[model samples]
Target: MPKEKSLVKNVMYKSLLSLFNIVVPIIIGSYATKIIGKDGMGEVFYADTIYQYFLIFGAFGIYNYGLREISRIRDNKEKLKQLFSSLFILGVASNIIVLLAYAGFIFFNYKGTSSFSIFAIYLFSIFSNLFYVEWANEALEKYDFITIKTIIVKLIYIVALLTLVKTPEDYLIYAGLISVALFLNNIISFVFIVKDIGFTLKCLTFRRHVKYLIMALIMANGNVLYTQLDKLFLGSNLGKDTVAFYTTPQNVVYMINAFIMSVVYVTIPRLSNILAANDEKAYLKLLNKVAKSLSLFLFPAAMGLTVLAREIILLYAKPEFLPAVPVLQIFTIYMITLAFESILSNQVMYVKKREKVLICFIICCGLFNLIAKIGLTKAGLLTPVTAVMTTVMANIILISLEFFYSTRVLKVDIPIFKLDKFKYLFISLLFIPITYGVKMIFASTVMITLVTMILCGSVYFGILLVTKDEVVIAILNKFLKRA
Candidate 1:
C-alpha cells in the first residue's frame, strides 16, 4: 500500500493556497476597481458570470467525479491511468461542445455589439478547460505542487494586470489576462498529470460512469444556478453596476468562506478512502473534527465581516459601493450556510454515494432562488441587498433539507449544531460590541478594520485557549512540537 500523506501538511498547504487566492484577488480587485470604476468592473464581472455558467456546462461534473474516482484507484497505476484518460477525454469532448454552444450564443445574442469583444475573450477559458486536469493531482494529494504553481502563476498574472490594464476600456485586456492565467494554470497541471499518469485512450470506458456523471452534472448546474443566477438577474433587471455592488461584497464573503473551507476540502479524499475501507468510526471521527474546525473558524469570520462590512467595502472598493454594506452582512449568513452545506452535500453525500438525494435537494434550492429573485425583480424590490437576502434564505432551506435527510433518511449522524459549535458562535458574537467600541475611538477606516480584526482574532482564540478547546489545543500542540 502507498503511504498516506500527512493531513496536517495538506491542510497547511491548502490554507496557504487559500490565503493567496484570497489576498491576490483583494489586491487585484481593489486596484482594478480603482482604475476601471463600477461600470467597467461590472461589465467584466457580468461577462465573467455568464462565462461561468457556460464553463459549468463545459466541466460537466468531471472534477468532482474524477477526484472521487481517481482517489479510489490511485494506488493502481494502470487503473489510475485508464480512469484519468477516460475522464480527460470526456472533459475535452464536453468542453468542445460547450465551447461551440457558447460561440453560438455569443453570435446570436451579443454579435456586432461592444460586449461581443468581452465575451469573445472569455471564450478562451472554455478551451482552457480542455487542459484542466487538476482533479487528478488533487486526488493524488499533491497540494504542495498545486499551491506553489498557483502562487507563481498568480504573481505573474498580477504583474500583467498592473502593467497592462491602465484604463476603463482595458476591461477587455482584463478579461483576456484572466483567460491567459487560467490557461497557464491548466496547461501546467496538464503536463504534470500526463507525466504522472501517461496518456492513453485504449482502455477508456464511459458507459459505467454515465449515471454518476449525470448526477454530478445536475448537482453542478443546481449549484451554479443557486449561486450565480442572482447576479444574472441583478445585472439584467437593475444593471451591471448592481451586479458589481452585489458581487463585490459577495466576493469578500466567498474569499473568507473559501479559506475556512480549505480545511474541509483537503479532507475529501481521505474521507472517501476511509468510507471505502468501511471504517465507519474513523469516518465519523474525522467528520466531527471537520465540523468543529469549521465552527471555530467560520463564526469569527462571519461575525468580523458583518461588523466591518463598511470599512471593508471602503477599503477594497470605491465609496459608491457603500450600498453593498448590507449585502455583505447578509452574505455573512450565507458564509455559514455554505460551509455547512459543503459538509452535508459535498463531503457526506458525495462520499457516501448519495448523489441523487443531494442533487434533488440542491435543485430544489436553485428553483427557490430563481423564483424568489424573479418575484423580487417583478415587484421592483430586487436591489443588491434584497437579492442577497433571498439567496441566504434559499441556502438556509437547502441546509435544513440536507440536515434532515442526512440524519433521518440516510441515518448519518453529523455533529452540525451541537453545543460545542454554538459555543464558537456565542464567543464570536463578541466581535460586534468590540468592533463598535473600537470604531468609536478610531477615525480611519483602515485603522478600524485592522484593529477590529486584530482584537477580535486575539480575543476569540484567547478564549478558545483558556477553555482548552480541543481543536485549538491540538493545533497549538502540533505547532509547539514542530517548533
Candidate 2:
C-alpha cells in the first residue's frame, strides 16, 4: 500500500475496533443493569472502573513510547527485543504494584471503596488489558495481523460475555468470568503478534531500562488518570449506578475522541521520525495538516453531539438512561477541549518535553475535578451531570495550560482551539432546526435518526465548503489528489 493508504488503514481499523470497545462495554453494562438492578450493576461497574484506574499503572506509557521506539528501531531485532522485554518487565512490576496498592486501598477502604476481593478480580482485568500492547504491531503499520487478532479476541469476548452473563444473581461472578476471557484474549493476541511480527524478546535487564520505564510509568498514569479518574471518583463518592449513568455520555464522547486520537496516534511515529531527521519545516507542516484535519471532523462532531445529545442518547439506550442525555451534552464539550489538547500533547511529547508538563497538568486537572465533583455532589447535583461538568472544566483548564506551553515548544502560535472552528460552531448551531424538525416528523426513531445524521453531515460539510475553510480545503485537496 501507498503511505497515505497505509496510514488510513491503521486509523480506520482501530477506529472501527475502538467503536466496539466503547459500544460493547455499554451493552454489557446495560444488560447487567437490567438483570442485576441498578445497584448491583453499579457495584460491578465500580469494580471494573476501579480496576481500570490501576490498569493505568500496568500501561506505564508503553502505548505511546513503545510504538514510537519500536517503529524507529524496527530494523534492529536485538534492540527491539530489548525494548519489548524491558517494557514487559516494567508492565509486570507495575501490575504487581497496582495489585499491592489495591490491597492497601481495600484494607483502608480508601474512603469507602469496595471490598478487596472484588478489587482483586478487577486486578485480573487490568492484566488482561495489557494485551493492548500487542497493538504495537498495528503501530508498526502491520494492520492485517492485528485486525485479524482483534476480530478473534473481540468475537470471543462478545461470545463469552453473552454466554456467561444472564441474571443479576451471578453479576459479580459473571464480571470475573469476563475478566478471564479478556486475559485469554490478550494471551492469544500476544502469541499471534509475536509470531506475525517475528521479533524475539530475550533477556533484558531492568537496571538498564529503568529510566525509560519510570518516565513511561509516569506518563501512562497521567494520561489514564485524566480520562478515567472521574469515573472512579464518581463511583466512590456518588454511587455506582451514578457511574453507569455517566458511562453512556462519557463513552459516546470518548468514541469520537478515540477516533481523533487514533488518527494522531498512527501518525506520531511518522511525526517522530521526521523530527528525528531534523526536518523542521516538514514537522510543522505535518503538525498543521494533522491539527487542521482533526479539527474539521472533531469540532463539528462534538458540537453537533452537544446539540442533539438528547436524541442520540435516548435513541440508543433505554428510558432509564435518559438522565445521561444532558450529561452527554456536558461531556461532549469536554471532547471539544480534548480534541485541541490532543494535538498539543502529541506535539509536546514528540519533542520529549511532554512528560513533566503533562504530569503536572493531569495532577492539577484531577485535583480540580475531585474538588469540583465533591462540591457539586454535596450541593445535590446529580452524579452524572456533576462529574461531566467537572471533567469538561478540567479539560478546558488543561487546554489553556497546554496552549501556553505548546506555543513555546513548537515556536508557533498553536491554538488547539483553531480559528476555522467557527465554521463548525456555525454549522453546529444549524443542527437545532434539524433537531426540531426531526422531533416533529413523527417517523420511526430509526428513520429519523438516519435522516437527521445525514442532514447534519450534509449541512456541516456544505457550510465548510461554501466558506472555503482552509482546513477542509487542504484535507480535501490531499485526500482527493490521492483518489
Candidate 3:
C-alpha cells in the first residue's frame, strides 16, 4: 500500500490553493469591479455568466472521473497511464467543440463574446484548460505542486488584467488577460503532470470505455445544471439587472462554498483509495473525522459573517449590491448544507458509482430549483435570495439521502447530524456574547472589523479548549508537539 501523507500537510496545501485561487483573485478582482461602477461591474458579470455556462459544457465531467479513477489505482502506473490516454483522446473532441463554440461566439456574437478579434485568447484558454484538465494532481494529493501553480497563475492574471484593462470599454483586453492567464497556468500545470505522472500519449486510449465515458458525461453535463444553469435562465427570463443582483450573492456564496470545500477536497482522494482497497475501518474513520473537522472550521466563518452581515455588506460592496448582503447571509446557512453535500458527494463517487448517483441527484435538484425560482418569482413570493434558500433546502434533502445510501453501502453508522442539530444552538449559546463584547471596544470601522476577527477566533478556540473537545486537543497537541 502507498503510504498516505499526514492530514496536516494536506489541509495546509489545499488551504494555500484556496488562497491563491480565491482570496487573491477576489480582493484584486473587487478592486477592478470597484473602478467600474455597479452597472459596469454588471457588464463584466454578464460576460462571466456566459463564460460559466460554457465552462460547464466544456468540462463534461472529465475532471471528476479522472480524479476518482486515478486515486483508486494510483499504484498501478501502467493502468493509470492508459486511463489518461483514454481520457486525453476523449478530451480532444470536447476541446474542438469548445473552440468552435468560441469561434461562433466571436464571429457572430454567439451570445456573449467580447469582440470579434479576441477569439485567439478564448482559444488559448480553452485549449490550455483541456490539457490541464487531464492532470490528476488533485486526486493524487500533490497539492504542493497545485498550490505553486495556483499562485503563479493568480499573479499572471492580476498583472495582465489590471495593466491591459484600461477601461470598461476595453473588454477585449479583459478577455485576453483572462484567457492568457488561464492558458499559462494550465500550461505550467500540464508540464508538471506530464513529467510527474506521465500521460504517455501512446498508451492512452478510450475506445472501449464508452460505457464509462457516457456515464461520466451524463454526470458532467448534469453538474453544469446544479452549478450554473440558473444564471443563464435568469438572464433569459428576468433580464440583465436581475442577473446582476442574483449573481452577486451567488458569486460570494460560490467562492465561500469552494473555500469551505477545500478541507473535504483534500480528503476525497484518500477517501477513494481507502474505499477501493476495502479498508472499511479507515474509510469510515476518514469520513467521520472529515465531516466533523470541516463542520467546526466552517461554523465560525459562516456564523461570523451572518453576525456582521449588515456591516460587511456596506463595508465591501456598492449601494446597488446591498441587495446581495441579506441574500449572502441567507447563503451562509446554505454554505453548511453545501459543504455537507460536497463531502458526502465524494463518497458517492468513491464508494458507490459517482457518475450514476450524481446524475440522478443533480437532475432532480436542478429541475426543482428551476421550478421553484420561476414559480416563486412569478408569485411575488420570493427574491432571488429566497429562491436560493429553497434550492439550498432541496440540495440538503437530496444529498442527505445520498449520504445515507453511501453509508449503508459502506456499512457505517449514521453521524449525529451534529452540525444541523446542535451547531447553531451551541454557537449562539457560546460565541454571540463574546463577539458583541468585542464590537464595543473597537469603535472605529477598521478597528472593529480587525478586532472582531481576532477576538472572535480566539474566543471560539478558547471555548473549544475549555469544553475539552477531542479534536481541538488533538490539533493543539500536534501543533505544539507536546503530546
Candidate 4:
C-alpha cells in the first residue's frame, strides 16, 4: 500500500507521526512534572535511562540495520520474510539475555533503592522493543500504517495517563502506563506483519547475520555511550532531581530535533537505493537539497530555543527547574549540530556503506563525552550544565569528522558549506531579536512562547520570500503549483 503512495503522501504521514511523538511527550512531561515535581520526574527518567541501556542490547541496531537491509530486498517477498524472521529471532534471543542481566544488575546494585521498582517497571519496555515491527514497515515506506498505529496507541496512552495518573505517589502508575502502551503498540504492529509479510523461520539462519549484526551492535554501543551516558552519569552522581532538571531542557531540544529529522529520515531508503545503484548524481542532488532544508529549519529552531530557554522552561517545567535555563541555552546549539550529524550519519554515511566511519566518529565522540562529563562533574560542576556543554562539544567533533570524511576522503561531491547556508543562517539569526522584542511585551510564559514562535516564524519566512532564497522559492513553487 505504501509502495503505491507518492513520496509527499508518505512524508505527510511521517510528519504527522513525528509531530505526535513530540506533542505527546510535551503533554505528558508537562502534566507529569506538575504531579510528580522535579525529583519524581527525574527518578522516572533516570530509570528510563537505565532501561534504555538494556534497550540498546535488545534493539541491536535493528532500527538502522534492519531498515536498510529490508529496504534493499523489499521487492522480493521470500527474502523479506526470511530476513525479518532472522532479525526478529535474533532480537528475541538478545533481549532475553539482556533482560536477565538487567534484572541481576538492579537486584545487586539497586536492591531496596527508591527508584528500583520504577526501574523494574521500565525494564518491560525491552520486551516491547524486541517485538517491534517498525523497521520492516519503515523499509517498505509504509509510513501511513506506522503513523496511524502510533497515533492510536499514543492517544490511548495519553487518555490513560490523564485518567489514571493523579499525584506524585502515582509515579509507578505512570511508568506502568508507558510500559503497557509500549507492549500493546508492538503487539498490534505485529498483527499487520502476519497479514502483510507473513511469519516464518523455514529458511532463515541467524548465524548468517552474525557479523553485520555485531557491527550494528558496536555502532549502537558508541551511539548510546554518548547519548544516554550523560543521564547515567548525572543520575548516578547528582541524584534524580538534578537529572530531572537536565532532562527537561534536553527533552525540548530533542523534540525540535525530532521534527527537523522528520524530513531527513524519509530520504534514507531512497538514498540507500541511489547509493546501491551508484547514482552519484542523484545522491549529490539529494544531499544538497537535504543540507539546505535542514539548515533552513534547524537554525531558527536552535535560535528560538536558545533565546526563549527561560520561557520554555517556565512553560514546560515548574519554577524549581529555573536552573535548567542555562542548560537549555547551551544545549540549544546541539539542535544545529545534531541536525547535520543525523542526516550525514543516517541518510548519507550509512546509505553509502560508511559504517566504519560512523563507528569511528561515534566512538571518538563517546570517549570525549565520557571524559569531559566525568571530569567536569568531579570538579564540582553540576550535572545538568556540565553534561549539556560536553555533549554539545562531542557532537561538534562528530559532525566535523563526518563532514571531513564524507567530502575529502570519500569524495562524495556534496557541498559541506554553501553561500545560501550563510544567507539562511543570517536570516534565521534575525529571529532572535525579533522574537525577543515580541517576548518582552508578554509576561505570560505561554503567550510569549506562542506569539514569538508565530510572529518570528512568519518574519523568518517573509524574509526568505523577499530574498527569493532558492530553497524557499523551490519549496513554495512546488507546493503552489501542486495546489
Candidate 5:
C-alpha cells in the first residue's frame, strides 16, 4: 500500500507547494526589502534567527523522527495514534523550556536593541511547531491536503504582506504578518490532522520515543548552526546591512534548494518503509530515481543561478543588494551539495538508523563553521560575501563526509550517482555561455535576466528534449500524456 502511494503524484503536489513557497517569498521579500530597506530586513531576520534557536530546541527533531516512525507504522491505527500522542507530549514539554529560555535571553542580552521587542514578539513561534502536524501528514503521504492548505495560507500571507507592510516603519507589522501566517498555517494543518485521525491522548509513552528524540535533537542542533547561525554571526559582526546582503541571495538559493528537496522529502517515508521491508531492489531503484530527479532539476537551477546571479539579486531585491552577487554565486555550489546531502542523509543514512554517523559528521561541520565564521569575523575577513563562501565550504565538507559514509562505511552498494547525471550537468552548463552572451550583448538588467532565463532555459530543455533525456522525457510523457 505504501509503495502504491504514487511517488509521481506526491511529487506533483509537493512541486505545487514548492512553487508557491519559492514565488511567494521572492515576491513578498522583494516588496518587503524595498519597503523595509536593508536595515529593517536585517532586523526582522536577526530577531527571526534568535527565534530559530528557540525553535530548534522546541522542535527537538521530533518532526523527522515522527515522520519516519509514523510512516513505518501508518497502517496500524492504534500504534500511529500512540506515537502521535507521545511525540505531541514531548514537543509540548520542550516548547515550554525553550520559551522560558528565550524570554530570559531577550530580557538579559537583547533588551537594548531596536529588534529586541520584535524578537520578543516572534518568540511565540516556539509553540507553532506543536500545532503543526506536517510530519504526520508527510508520513501519511497526504500531499494533496498539505499542498492545498499551504497554498491558502501563503496566498493570505502574500495579501497581508502587500497590504499591511506599506512603509519602512511597518517592519514590526511585517514581522507580525509573517508570524500570523506561520501560526495560521500550523493550526490549519492541525485541524485537518484532527479530521483525519481525531484526537487521542491515551496510551502515550515518552520513554519509548526518548532515544530517537535525543538523536533528533542532536541532528537538529548540528543543522541549526550552519543555517540559522550564519545570519546571527553576520548580524553581530557586520550588522544588518551585511545580513541583508548575505541573506538576500541566500534566500533565493534556499528557495531553489527547498524546491528540489521537496521531492526528496516526499520520498523519505516511502524509502523508510522500503528499507524496513528489506526490498533492496525497490530501494535501489528508488535511490536511482531520486538521483536522476535531482540531476534533472538541480543542474539548471544551480547553474542558472550562477549564470544570472547579478540579474537575480537586482531583480529580487534591488540594486542596493548588488553586493550579494558573489554570495549568490558561491551558494550555487552549496545548493548542489545540499541537494545530494539530503538524499543520501535522509533516504539512505537516516533510514538505516545511521544517525550517529550523521550526527558526528554534522557536528564537525557545525563546529568548523562556528570557528571559521567567528574567527573570520573577528579577523575582519568575513564580509557578507566571504561569510557566504565560508558557509559553502562547510557544506562541501559536510556532504563529502556524508557521501563517504553512505558509500564506503554503510556500503549500501547501490548506484547513488548515475551516469545520466553527467548528461544533465553538461546540458545545464551549456546555458552559461549563451546566457552570458545575451547579457553582454544587451546590457544586464532585470529585463535581460528574464529574457536570458527564458531563452536559455528553453534551449537547455530543447537539447534535453532532442536527446530524450530519460528523466526529462519521463516527466514530460507523464504530464503530456494526461493532457
Candidate 6:
C-alpha cells in the first residue's frame, strides 16, 4: 500500500479546489447578474432553493455517512466494495422515489409557469445524482483528482455560460448549464471511482445502515431549515427580487466560509481514522491545530467582510443589490459561527460517533430558525435584513449548544478560548480602522476593495510573524523550501 499524503498537502489541494469553486461562481454570477438582471437571477436561484430541498431528501444523508464509513474501511477492499455497493444502491432507490414526488409537485403547483420550465431542466440533477458518488473519492482522500476534475468541468461550464446565456430570456438555459455541470461532475466521479472500489451487490445489507441513514436524513433536513429555507420564506413573503437581495450576499459569505472550512473538511477522514483507532491524544492535538488555524484566518475574514461589505456588493452585484450590503455585514457573524460549528459538529461530534446528540442540537436550532422567520413574516417584518439577522442568531445558538455539549457533556477538551486565538482576533480587529482609512482615501470601489484586502492581509500575517506564531512559521518554511 502507498503512504498517505501529509495533512498540509491534502489541505493545499482542498484549498485549491475551494478557491476554484469560489472563483468560477464569482465569474458566472458577476456576468449572469448583469445579463439576466435581479429578477432573472432571483428566479433562477429561487428554483434552485426549492430544488435543494428535494435534493437533500433524495440524498438521504448518504454523503456524510458514506464518507465516514468508507474512510474506516478504505484499506479493506472487500469491505469497501460491499459498503459502496449497498450505499450506491440505497441512494439510487431513494432518489427515484424523491424524483417522482418532485415531478408531481412541479406538475401540480409550478406547471404553466417559467419556473415550471426551470424545474424541468433541474430534473437532470436528480437523475445525475444516481451516479453521484463523489463521497467515495473524498473518503479515499483523492483531492488531487477531485480538484482537477472540477476545474476542467467548471471551465467547460464557464464557456457554456458565456456562449449560450446571452439574454435574460436565456435564464432557463443558464439553469440547464448548471445542471449539466453537476451532471458532468457526478458522471466523471462515477467513472473514476471504480478503480478504487468496484461495485458489488453480493454482500449488501440495508437493514444495518437504515438507522444511521435516517438520523443523517433528519440532521441534514434540520440543517436545510436555516440554510435554504430562508430563501423559500423570503421568496414567498417578499418576492423574487427580495430573494435576490438576500441570496446574493449570502452566497458571497458562503463562498468565504467554504474556503475557511476547507481546512476542517479535509481532516474529517483523518480525524475519523484516528478516533476509530482510539487515539485520543493525537485526535485532540490535531483538533487544536485545526482550531488555531481556523482562528488565524476566520477572525480576519469576518472582519474584512464586515468592513468591506459594501465594496464587495458593488464589485459582484449591481446597485439594486446594495440592499444586500447590510445583509452581508450581518452574515460576518454567521460565517464565524459556521466555521466553529464545523469543527465541533463535523470534527468532534460526528467523528466521535455522537450523532444523536448532534442531531438534537441541529433540530432544536433549526426549529427556532423556522419559527422565528415565520413569525417575522406573519408580523410583516421579514425583509432581507431581518431574515439574515434571524439566521445569524440561529447559528449562534446552534454553535453555542454544540460547544457546550462537546466540552461539558462529552468531556471533550476543546481549547476554544486559548489566548493565542484571542491574539489573532485582536489583530484582526485592527482591520476595521485600517480599512476605514483606505476607504476614505479611495473613491473607486475596485481600488478600495483591492487595497483593503492587500493591506489587511499583509498586516495580519506580519503581526503573526512578529509574534513567532508556530503555524505561520511552519507554513512559511514550507513555501520557502519550495521556492
Among residues 3 or more apart in sequence or in different chains, the pairs in candidate 6 whose N, CA or C atoms overlap within 3 Å are none
Q: Evaluate all candidate structures by whole-model CA lDDT and list the values in order.
A: 0.89, 0.68, 0.67, 0.81, 0.83, 0.88
Candidate 4 C-alpha lDDT tens digits along 1-483: 444556666667888888888898888878888888887788788888888778877777777888888877777889889999889888888888888889898999888978689878866887677688788888889888889999999999999999998989998999999899999989888888868998896998777687777777777566476658888888878787888887888888888788777778887776776676778898889878878877888788888888888888887878999999998998888777777788778876887777877887898888889888778877878467878778888999888888888888877765646777767778777777877687668888888888888888898999888878887887788789889
User: What's each prediction's TM-score?
Assistant: 0.98, 0.85, 0.89, 0.95, 0.96, 0.98
Off by over 4 Å in 3: 105-123, 170-172, 201-203, 220-223, 380-382, 407-410, 419-425, 428-444
For model 6, residues 1-483, the per-residue Cα lDDT tens digits are 212767888899999999888887887888898889898999898988988889988998998899888888888889989999999999999999989988998999999876799888878889888989988888888889999999999999999899999988999889899899999999999989976689886979899998999887876577587868789998987899999998898889888888888889888888888887899999999999999988888899899999999988888888878998999998888888888788888888888888999899988888899999989988999988898788888988988999898889889998767797778889998998998899789999999999999999999999888989998998899999989
Q: What is the lDDT of candidate 4?
A: 0.81
Model 4 lDDT at residue 216? 75
- Clash count for each candidate, listed in order shown: 0, 0, 3, 0, 0, 0
**Model 4: how far residue 460 lies from native, Å:** 0.5
User: Considering summed lDDT, which 10 consecutive residues are worst modelled in model 2?
Assistant: 1-10
lDDT of 1 by residue, 45-103 (tens): 89999998998878889888988888888888999889899988888989999999999
State the lDDT at 470 in candidate 4.
Answer: 88
TM-score for model 1? 0.98
Candidate 6, lDDT over the whole model: 0.88
Which 10 successive residues of model 6 have the least lDDT summed?
A: 1-10
Model 3 error, position 286 (Å): 0.8
Candidate with the larger lDDT of 1 and 3: 1
RMSD of each: 1.1, 3.7, 3.2, 1.8, 1.6, 1.2
lDDT of model 2 at position 364: 84
Q: In terms of TM-score, which candidate is stronger, 1 or 3?
A: 1
For residues 1-483, what per-residue lDDT tens digits would candidate 3 score against the true structure? Answer: 233677678787787777666676457655655555566555556666666556655666677778778888888888877777677667767777877787667566643543334444556667766776534777767888788877877887787677776765665666667777777777787778777767666755566666666666666565354435555655566665656666666666666667767778777778778778888778777777777777777778787777766566555556666777777788787777777676666554434565566667767877877777677768876555666677677777767776676667645554537554355337644556765886777666566667777778877777778878777787788878843
lDDT at 31 for candidate 6? 88
lDDT of 5 by residue, 1-483 (tens): 455788899998998899889998888888899889888888887787778777887888898899899889888878887888788778888888888888888999878977677987777676576686789899999999889998998888888888788888999998888878889989998888767766677877988788888887787576576867778877877787888887888889989888888878998999888888888889888888888887888988999999888888877887888988988998898888888777777888888898887898888998898899889877879787777677778888988888887788887754546676867788787777888778778885866887888887898889988988888888889989889
The stretch of ten residues in a row with the least summed lDDT in candidate 3 is 110-119
Quote the lDDT for 1 in model 2. Answer: 20
Error of 5 at 393 (Å): 1.8
Instruction: Candidate 5: give the clashing pairs.
Output: none
For candidate 5, report its TM-score. 0.96
